[model samples]
Target: MFIGGLGRSGTTLLERLLGEVPGVAPLGEVVHLWERGVIGKEPCGCGEPFTTCPFWRRVGIRAFGGWSTGLADRILTLRRRVDRTRHIPALAARRCRVGLSGYTRAYSRVYEAAAQVAGGRVVVDSSKHASLAFCLRTSPVVDMSVVHVVRDPRAVAYSWRKQITRPEDGTPMTRWPSAWTAVHWLVQNLAFELLARRGGTVIRVRYEDLLADPPAVMQALLTRLGLGGVAVTFLRQGVAELSVAHTCAGNPMRFAAGPLDLSRDDNWCDRQPRLHRWLVTALTWPLMLQYGYRPRDRRTPEGAVAPWLTAGVAAQECR
Candidate 1:
């Protein structure tokens, strides 16, 4: 399964919760693994360098006959060539398949290898990039389902301005200004909506709903995916039981394990700059309302119905 959303939109949190599900294997962000995990030798979720981690080592061997600086470099170059947000338009045309063959094959190999390494558990890739999602759509070998997670634009914009540190490397995580985030947020979400209109199973979920009632959200997802037998015992009483897995690059929270407090992080309401919030809402008003986010009600009242297409969500979970 692929989790699609903008950065800092709770994709990591959803993936971590899904990791605890039986018959599921979480691969943090394979879209970044070629560079961050393989070339840069960043820490995996297990807290070991990807080159030294047994899980990734096996994946490399299975995927490409073993890891080497040369192979990593080659794939990284291919990734940049074919996988990019701007390339989504061409990829959607589906006529670029011939040119994208190399990366498509490489990507399929990574998931295949991961599935093999994880004893055939379903691989959950929380890459959270609309461009990457479209790239994967071109691959015949990858059977992907999308969990399109949406959050309030104001909250998402506020998140982009905060300083965060990467747990994988000692470097700081990427941060974007509110305007930049607003534009990308609109584009990314629209891309996913376009993707659903084209093909494949795409289930939409509000990030607020997921944070508020993880058990219900996760159970609804599993049941929709026909994995109704899997128990979501890991989430209960507003806490999530996280386990170490070989996730690649993601939010620093990916490094966290054991019991984690699943409180709603709504720091944006009061802390965000009024100018930034207004700009974000103005830039994204039309689609924002389509997603059920109120333009005036920037402050999502505590315990109120999550601002989203709840009926659309219910239809998806049932289907």
Candidate 2:
């Protein structure tokens, strides 16, 4: 049961919790062939390095032609050579689709090989990308179960702004103006919404509820995936330490490494900049309303029907 979604949408938390479960192998973001030069890295908190890691090593054994580690590095170089200065959406789409095809081929080969190595029925990959999700679903080798994880739009924009501003001299992305950011939030969410509805076992998970009560949320997910009851013991242990990788080489992000941490809910209220809160709300307002988020603008918040409150959340009271 692969847990897929947008970045920073609690995939790591889910991976960690599920990793603790017996009989389930959790390799967070093993996007091995997507970009290259990843294997020689240090142990990701999951207790293994890319090169020496049993997971990838086994995956390497079965991959048809034994693709080199340098494959990802080469792809990165080619991507950098592309010119995308004007930010034209049509051009961007055309260029991205062209490049995406190669990556998809490599990804499919690597995962198919890795699946053989793991010897487990399911491999959880939290490398969330709508395009990749689309490709994987269509691939003959993959029988993917996509988990469309979502959070408030304001929260997403807030986090994006934080990461974009951090110390990165190379490949820095321009910050989206609030309106543009909202538009992006809607677009990405809409993509997932459409995919989920077209559905064959697509699950939508909310970051808020997942953080608020992980064990219960996880149990429901495992049941839905038909993962049996083996995950229960892992849930009782609280959290597990796991390794993770980013889309770029040498740019790994750990689960507990930074400010917009997922170990808790309401991270937005705590870590978000004052300005981002408004932008987040504006962009994600419709979604927030749709997903049962209480609308602050209304006298009676959205979804506030009497007896609507579950006993567990009743003490918190309605907004």
- The TM-scores, one per candidate, come to 0.94, 0.69
Positional deviation of 252 in candidate 1, in angstroms? Answer: 0.5
How many residue pairs collide in each prediction? 1, 5
What are the per-residue Cα lDDT tens digits for candidate 1 across 10-102?
Answer: 899988988888778899988888778878899999999989999999999998998887877887777778878888888887857444778
| TM-score, structure 1 vs. true | 0.94
Expressed as tens digits, the lDDT of each residue in 1-319 for candidate 2 is 5565656566666666665555455556655333332534544443354455556666655764443547657655543433222322333234444554554555566666655665556666776655446545444556777766766666656655654422222445455555666676666666656556555356777776666556666666666666746546433334534323221222234323322333544445667666756756766777778766654642222223323123323212111
Task: Give the Cα RMSD of candidate 2.
Answer: 7.2
lDDT of each: 0.83, 0.53
**Residue pairs with backbone atoms closer than 3 Å in model 2 (clashes):** 35-72, 36-72, 36-73, 46-243, 154-280
Backbone clashes in model 1, listed as residue pairs: 28-247
* Candidate number with greatest lDDT: 1
Candidate 2 weakest ten by summed lDDT: 310-319
